[model samples]
Target: MDIPRSFRKTLLAHLPYAVNEDFTAADDLAALGLNSMGLVQLLTDLEETFGLELPDELITEETFATAGSLWATVSELVPAGQFSDA
Candidate 1:
């Protein structure tokens, strides 16, 4: 599925560092210059964007590394009755 542009925009805004990285693809979260705070903010943005109830486990490096991966994870974790910011 084609991911929403809002997801990308929100992620970049919270990134607060080099906004030029190709975040659409899988890359190291640390390599993208995201510190712990940045990652927390990014998690908030993702939660708001997708309306997913995030667990602590979902906030790992692998799950949130890429826009595509993040969305997929959210889609999986977000339950049938879970809200979507649609």
Candidate 2:
């Protein structure tokens, strides 16, 4: 589960309960041992890392089921028009 350093660090820091290998988009995020409190922190860290204000529409269970999926969604939501700002 070697991924971008930033993603890996962010995942480890935020989703402390989740492991790096849970890269699929169907893995239970909660099964990884996350609680509702941790999920909020993870979202905040992800938003800060990617520089995108993610709407709940993209934060659904289907979209954030795993580490890889979370990284993909963040990469996709990142402001393509301005990387510097991000």
Provide TM-scores for the models: 0.64, 0.67
Please, what are the lDDT tens digits per residue for candidate 1 over residues 21-59? 345555555666778888788888777766767888777
- Candidate 1 — which residues are off by over 4 angstroms? 17-22, 77-86
Q: For residue 68, give model 2's deviation from the true position in Å.
A: 1.4
Question: What is candidate 2's lDDT per residue for 1-86, written digit by digit as tens?
Answer: 33466666666665555566434445566767656787788889877767778898887776666766776777777765433322
What is the model-wide C-alpha lDDT for candidate 1?
0.65
Off by over 4 Å in 2: 18-28, 79-86
lDDT for 17 (candidate 2): 58
Instruction: Estimate candidate 2's RMSD in Å.
Output: 4.4
Candidate 1's displacement at residue 57, Å, is 2.5
Instruction: Report lDDT per candidate.
Output: 0.65, 0.65
